[model samples]
Target: MASEQMPPVVTLHEEYGCGAREIGERVAASLGVEYVGRAMKSETIDEIAGDADEGGFVERFLRSFTPIPSHDANIAWALEAHADHEVADQNNRYLADLAQDGAVIHGRAGAHVLADRPATLHVKLIAPLSTRITRAATEAGITPERARHRQAREDRVRTDFCRRLYRWDPRENDRFDLVVNTASFTPEQAADLIVTTYRLHFPV
Candidate 1:
């Protein structure tokens, strides 16, 4: 149990292609805690364009371009997706056990894992699909068109994982204590806002 006067812990859930990673970084920096988006992303997301030996991202399982032409193909895809989900679930459990109270954990279903902790503040980071696609494109230095393709694929897998595991709809607004629309603010500006908001709720 927490001391009654302690501030709430913070959990940041981010949509694909959003700038939540950077914002999470700045918020953690402002509040003097560890930032965590990359730890989760690098462990789960496969590096599509990098060397196999390099650890840019690890693949939980394969993703295919060939169509799921039949019922069997669909089944195979679902099994693969499930395998990945299991791996992610294990990681999330480890994350929860390792997290110190009051740490701002970004992603890795940190919100759900830390739900039992009193005064936990859950935040959702989102933007218009176009805005997020642009951000992903710029980060990858790819054309917006290609970015859209990648974003769609990422979004589908992510949505499936969350829904399958926790029955949580990432699109639902009510799940979060604070939801930030990243499209309107610069990354730095958004970060500042989050930091300010978090501080207001957790004055020391």
Candidate 2:
């Protein structure tokens, strides 16, 4: 394959509790490139996990278990709340900046946000709940049940944010070019596949 055809950008969105982060890292390593996550780019998670008065704070503060009437309403609320972080400008800027470079970007709607870019290979990483629970427990050094709860909390918050802001479920299938199940494949195998695909589709 020629370099011009190679994909210059790659993005992965994973379900919470999935080993997406680790796998993203490995894939970037295999490709000799960068790996980035939304957490790395924004402090929203830290603020939300802490005592900040971020947007949707009051509502989410009440209880994550409270279900919105529809996923779209929740995504709208999350976008509205995103202003609290004062990161919207930064987010757009960074998304534009990312177009100048390629990396293993983990979250913060990197795929959808950077859709204008022509060379990105979008991927979604998913795994069974059991795989996620075990991965989180082993990595976080917590019990399985506790890990499950924590994973669910994190997943819910992120999903809620996406639903409210984009009217799109993070788990939806349309946003990705390739979807990998980590439960069935080793991270290295996943990385190998991504790299191979990159070489095939993105000869740049």
Candidate 3:
């Protein structure tokens, strides 16, 4: 539903320590659009749940994360599945609303949520394990060994987030309009490349 008058939307998905947030900020600045980070989307969800206390998404989403007795295992599983779908639907609507104007969204499954929107670019950033571990360690001021462990945990969580909610595997390169290996480019350079591609697809 995008029009020529509206600015383009950009979604960037990256592995841990790939500088997704910084790159997304740069892209947003260059395009003069709002930059929506993963934390912002999560906060929005929390706010929604808080505003609507009971008999709504709050109870279902919370139930998805809590344990139930053995006697209610089947019922719990069903509720969990329903909760996952509800969250996905909410996320999609939120992203769609943002894309109506134009936004550079970092993480929170932006790529999957806005895949069908016109004048939108879907980007993914990746690097080898060694490269990412080194970057993560330097950024967090932690040892490479600890960074590696954190990377494994975070990667699993992100992959599962996409797979469980959207049934989309982000590792599939075909899903992205542009896939950059961040090991080869600085964050600014990556942002430049993405902006160039965006302009090409959605000329101003």
In terms of lDDT, the best-performing candidate is 3
User: What are the per-residue Cα lDDT tens digits for candidate 2 across 71-112?
Assistant: 587785774465433444556578667656567788877767
Give candidate 3 misplaced runs (Cα > 4 Å): 1-3, 39-71
How do the residues 1-204 of candidate 3 rate in per-residue lDDT, one tens digit apiece? 345567778999888778787899999999989999874332344454454533354343444455344468788788677777777787888888898778999887888877777788999999988999998888778889878766765666567667778788887877699999999999999999999999988876
| Model 1 lDDT per residue over 57-164, tens place | 123332332223346877877765676566667767666655554567776666666766655667888899888988988987888987886676566656554665
Tell me the lDDT of candidate 3: 0.78
Residue 14's C-alpha lDDT in candidate 2? Answer: 81
TM-scores vs. true structure, each candidate? 0.71, 0.75, 0.82
- The TM-score ranking, best first, is 3, 2, 1
Q: Which stretches of candidate 1 lie over 4 Å from their true place?
A: 1-8, 38-89
Better of 2 and 3 by lDDT: 3
Candidate 2 regions off by >4 Å?
A: 1-7, 40-86
Q: Which is better, 1 or 3, measured by TM-score?
A: 3
